[model samples]
Target: EGDGAHGGFPADGVHRTSRLTAPPPVPPRSRLPRPRRGPLAIVVAVLLVLGVGTGVWYINSGQFTKVPPLLSKTEAQARDRLDEAGLDVGKVKHAYSDTVERGKVISTDPGVGDRIRKNDSVSLTVSDGPDTVKLPDVSGYRLDKARELLEDEGLEPGMVTKAFSGEVAKGFVISSKPGSGTTVRAGSAVALVVSKGSPVDVPDVTGDDPEDAKAELAEAGLKVRIADERVNSEYDSGQVARQTPDPGGRAAEGDTVTLTLSKGPRMIEVPDVVGDSVDDAKRKLEDAGFNVDEDRGLLGLFGDTVEKQSVDGGDTAPEGSTIKITIR
Candidate 1:
């Protein structure tokens, strides 16, 4: 009661009641959670925008693209390159080449370094190999026809030779150099062989010895065919009497020349040479195929006429048999 403001006691001298301690007031900044620090939303947004821009650039970058050079590239490689550039592969063809290797690309249709649209097809020309060809079967063909065939096969006619061939016709090819089915470079030379027909000229061999006749016939490209049946003729025994095909006739090469050899004069009848002049008797005896022996010891001293004969007339004797005629 004495201190009403400081204590709860009333002002009066009545009883005062004592109470527990009062709670203190909390500070304004103490209840908040701990502040967190991480990457900014703005930075994340910038990264997202950059990624989208790059993807767009990559997906749509083929409209104004130029064709890539593809010369000398393999077919597979060229196809891959075209695919990478968003282009298509076109028709493929093969051609022989001299400088380009086989199984390699020789060139392109639109060519390298040309401007083209994306997705457009590019034609490809592949190399087969060097320009080469296989020789054809021109043997036995006509000369002119063989030449034509050679030309058609991309070959050239080189040397031409003529020869005798029994199996091939005249003016026809007998054989060919490099033969048939042989591979060679284009425009290469091919030698030709031509036939010279079959017939040959038979030489004149009459009156020649058998050995000489054989040599002559051989020189003329002919063979000999001596006949077994000999003939009686003016030619001496073992001499050529006659020949078939005559002299200076034509015959095939390797043909046999038939020849008839002589066996001297044949047997004949003796003529009546008696009572004839000496010259007349000689002529008569010779004509009758007989050798005349004159006995002029007694008759020949008196006259120039034949007096007697050794063999009677109309008698057969050896053609070359000797006969005696007494002449005066």
Candidate 2:
């Protein structure tokens, strides 16, 4: 009976220990107080949502726009369109165009339907209709003055031709190609016809006495001027050596003719070439300021030696006189 009692006591002790070691019952989860969402709180929440949406929209679409169709629109109209598209007007340029009307938009920088940032600038090319000007009347104007007028009118001066005109003074414009008051493209070259005053035949005065030459030129209704310097020529000293506009060239009636007087032929020593080769003799004579004339007799047709010379060695003759050499 004692054993049974001891065993029962141990069993009871184990039961108690089990009860002590058991975990405590979990308390009911306390519920947070129901948030009292007032009008202000609701509005704040709504604003936060809206801000996020706006940020997304701005990043994706709000910051960008497309260029509008602006071709052929007037500048004022284009500006208005750009403003409506939330864009700024950039550089405005003008260019000549044959197809586009004047003062209208010829093209745009970004082009129509091109994507660009909102408020970005767009360049515009405005049209200035076909560049043209009326041909000006420059007749009777001096050549230099006429050219200036052409440039001022946006035209280029072209080929110039001269003709004798009794009415038009020398060095003056007679007329212009395409005539006056004709509409032509800007920068078009305009040819001009200049006048050479009533023509006068220049008289031949070379080899004549200076006074006689001057009187003869004056009788042709021309003025005469003597040159300040004299030149060596075939003419005798104190005679007119040359006249210009020379004998055949025509000149204006009142034009001046300049006469150069001669100082007579220059004397030079003849070179000795009698025993030299034909080529050597010719070279030596020419180097001495004398022209060489070959006299190859039948016997000397193929000969290379110079057998004789017209002028003897050590003699003096006109510098330009011909030196005849006989080859044998």
Candidate 3:
């Protein structure tokens, strides 16, 4: 009984002992309520990301652009193109250009496809076409002097045509095409009409002696000039072979007539082609320095064979003389 009383405890004591020995119940964790994510929060997050992206983009490429292609474009077109590219037109200048059209954009300051800042000015060099100059009066001037004047006026001396003029002296300019005071492009060819004073008939001096030719030309109010180099012609040696301005041609008074003396006709041996075809014979004769004349009679109209030749083979004939061949 005593042991029971000592060893065994009362129910209240047992309960107290159990409560002290065992760990106290952990108080239900008092967590704060999780905040609910709403549409407004999502929107704020998205806006922050967009703002960062925009800042990066603006810093890199937003303030500049490439120059637009403006070569060969008109002023209005270039302006429009620059406007579209967010650029301004700067100093506009005009210059002459042979290849570019007038009023067209020849080049840009920044050059096409070059990087430039937005809203910045782009200088343009517009074409004014070719340069122009006023033609000066060169009438009555000597041909050489007139050419000099034209060159000084930025013009090219073009074809010179001569005509008889009673007022203007020989070898002087009568007038110019496009006339005086006419505005013409620089480097333009200008034709001039030169005067050949009072016409005089040129006497035929060919085949005449040099002394006779000179005397005859002098009597006709013309001067005579003998060429240094003599040419081979049908006329005899030491005789006048050719005269230019030629026979019956008109010339100016006191004008010089040049005479070329002859060194006699050159003789060459003919080729043998009696049995050859007509075409072959002609080729051989022509190659031997002689002109070919085909004599195809009624019977030889369809003949191709050369049966006879006027100058036989191995015979000497004057160079450039005609060689007749009979075909059968």
Candidate 4:
């Protein structure tokens, strides 16, 4: 064939080769738009499922029991009973009561014959019995006043006994058995010791030997002593010359009486203090070795002058003697 062509085609001009190329690949699935589950949608679906489960549990988990009457039962017993019945112990309150004993159950919250859910706490109210009060100090107070004091302390007066007491006045309380500042239950009895008038009476015992005199005075409920200074008297020496209050005189029991034994004479001349002012009379008698005592009559009370003397002027007596003067 000729090398030239009319359509300008190379016709086996030089041994040239043409090869076919591959087409473009398909797009990946990851590059296209995709459906999504956001945080809000996920949360809402989870909550809905949880709510349905909770409602089912709430409707089916209810188990109830009747609260048995725990009235008057001890706290331990009540707690044990409640626990056995699948219940819990709630608030425990205390109150004072007159009818119920102490440390006992008085009442209950939610009451008796009420239905309560299992593991529910039941309230308990316990009693403390009657209230307590401090024992008052009624010593030295009059009986009537002491009763009032006991009443004020919310206590009851127990026993009243009468006794003679030198320290406590008549018609007054000497002491209480439990004493003061003691705490006791309300309406508790308190034993009392009340005073009754004077103590005792003293008898006469004079002119006896010192030892013998003491014995006699002891029998008569009186105390005896010997004077420091002896005197000369008609009685024999070493014998009691005279005793205080003379003889057959009234003296308080256990009162000491001084016995002046004879040791020759030691007489003193009495001084006249009558018709003088009380101050002047006392001074004059004391200067003359005499003890001055006074007695004011009903009409002569608060008087400043002495009206009469126990011993007249110029009379003889013991050097140290008591001279009573009536004031007017």
Candidate 5:
């Protein structure tokens, strides 16, 4: 009885020890996951918030001012008044007005009571007085002088044309491009044509004998004419001597000139010594042409026959030139 086990136990005489224990069961784990953010997404969100703040600041800072609508105030007075009102004066625009005097303010930008930030500019239109000015007649004045007068009157000169002026002297201003009394811009240009003196055609002196070269030149357009002639004794006499400046030369119209003429070359007549010995004949002719010669053989001893001679019967040569004769 003492060894028997309780229901279904082994009846052997061995008793069982306590069973081995296992680790306590693990506690059930929570399934929660960690939150994550990318670098680009975080940067974009930061930039968006900064951009919104900057835009709000830009809108709040922008501001504009309006000028008073006052009329007929002097420019200085308008500016002073605006400054006194804690506003700044801006660009002054000028315009012609029959109703307002020059340098007076005609109107202002944005009327009075315009809310503006500090340093806001208020623009004003200024009067340039009346648009009309009595034009000075500068037709006869020199171009430069006329320009000065026009500029003084705040007018411009325009257009120049040149015309022959029988009354006006050379190099003087003839007239302006535009007739006087024309209204134009203050800096407009005036054209001027100056006198260049009288115009005349050049003279012609071609083919005229130098002896009459001067007279012919006078008949033409030339007032002054010069003729140079050198006689070639070897050339035919009385023909036009050699001319210098050959034919055509230029001279002012109506200019006078000096003339040269040919005096026939100084000449000596050839001596006649026919029927004489060749040597003696040669001596006479040579003296005229400047020498003497003799033939060979029996004719040489007798002084032979005079055969050929230069200048045959009646030809002329320069006074000092020599003529030769052939003796047989």
Candidate 6:
């Protein structure tokens, strides 16, 4: 009725509705445009991919693989297996063991069932056979027989030396080098010293001149005697009388030869000097190489004249002897 005149009241038609008081036109409700999630969806998808990749890498790595056990296998066989599995073989050290064979594997570093990564190495202990054998006592045995025995024992016969031994018989072993009962590896050499026999003598020359005697004895492959005795004879005066390793006896070479010697002329007393001029007496006795003690002085019946001597006149004396004289 009102707007029918303006539409009813025209000019001041219904006081204008307050714009501030009217609720904003309800936003058009086109169903929220489907959420545009391009960046967010991409971020979530990347996270999922990373997680799956980590899981796959871990499974394919050897870190998660089980190592095989190989204690009973031969060294060669074990080495081949390790190589095939992308593992390496380390150095091999040898040791003596009663339960292991000469060249077989004694044991492994990580043992039978240890876990290890690829390209890792496993050390090995190999067998060098039982400890060395003790050499048997073989000295005094025949050389040929000893050699056979050594050969049977897997040892060698080294150099053989010939010697004359009193303790061991000829053609028999006297002793061995490297000694007996010493530990040695198979095929090791043993040196030998064999006895030839006891030595023998040549001859005896006890009455010959020293120089001549040495020559004669040497010529006969014998030795000489050296002896001392009293003698008046000129020929072979102080020479050997007896010998040993007697003339026909046996002895070693370089054996000592003994002998006796002759003691020269015995001494006698000097003659008396009474009534003889002291100077003349001195000259005579001194010319004979005698030692003289003089007693002549200026106080006697025959002043400075020799009156008495140690021994009477005409007494025998050694050619070169000492004499004492008393003068008045």
Indicate which candidate wins on lDDT: 3
TM-scores of the models, in the order given = 0.39, 0.55, 0.55, 0.36, 0.31, 0.31
Superposed model 4: Cα runs more than 4 Å off: 1-65, 69-91, 97-104, 110-121, 127-130, 200-328
| TM-score-best of 3 and 6 | 3
Q: TM-score of the candidate numbered 5?
A: 0.31
Inter-residue clash pairs, candidate 4: 231-263, 232-264
The segments of candidate 1 whose C-alpha lies over 4 angstroms from its true place after superposition are 1-63, 130-133, 152-154, 164-169, 185-187, 197-328
Instruction: Tell me the deviation in Å of residue 50 in model 2.
Output: 3.1
Cα RMSD to the true fold for all candidates = 21.6, 12.7, 12.9, 14.4, 19.7, 16.6
lDDT value, candidate 2, whole model: 0.92
TM-score of structure candidate 3 = 0.55
Model 5 has an lDDT value of 0.62
Clashes of each: 7, 0, 0, 2, 11, 22
Cα displacement (angstroms), candidate 2, residue 75, comes to 9.4
Cα-based lDDT at residue 219, candidate 3? 97
Task: Tell me the tens digit of each residue's lDDT in model 2 across 18-97.
Answer: 44576899999999999887999989999999999999999998899999999999999999999999999999999998
Output the TM-score of candidate 2: 0.55
Point out the worst 10-residue segment of candidate 5 by lDDT: 199-208
The alpha-carbon deviation from the true structure for residue 307 of candidate 4, after best TM-score superposition, in angstroms, is: 66
Assess candidate 1 and give its TM-score to the true structure. 0.39
lDDT of each: 0.84, 0.92, 0.93, 0.82, 0.62, 0.70
Tens-digit lDDT track of model 1 for 1-328? 4455446545665785688897897767766886665578668888999889877865675354666778778889989998998889999999987877877788886777776777888899998888889999999899999999999988999999888777888789999999999999898999998886687877887778899999989888788999999998757788898898788877767678899999876768888877888888899888877788888895367788888888988887767778998876
Model 6 per-residue lDDT tens digits across residues 147-195: 8888888788889988767777778888887788888877678888987
lDDT of candidate 5 over 260-327, digit per residue (tens)? 34455556676654456676776677666644444444554544666666655356556656666556
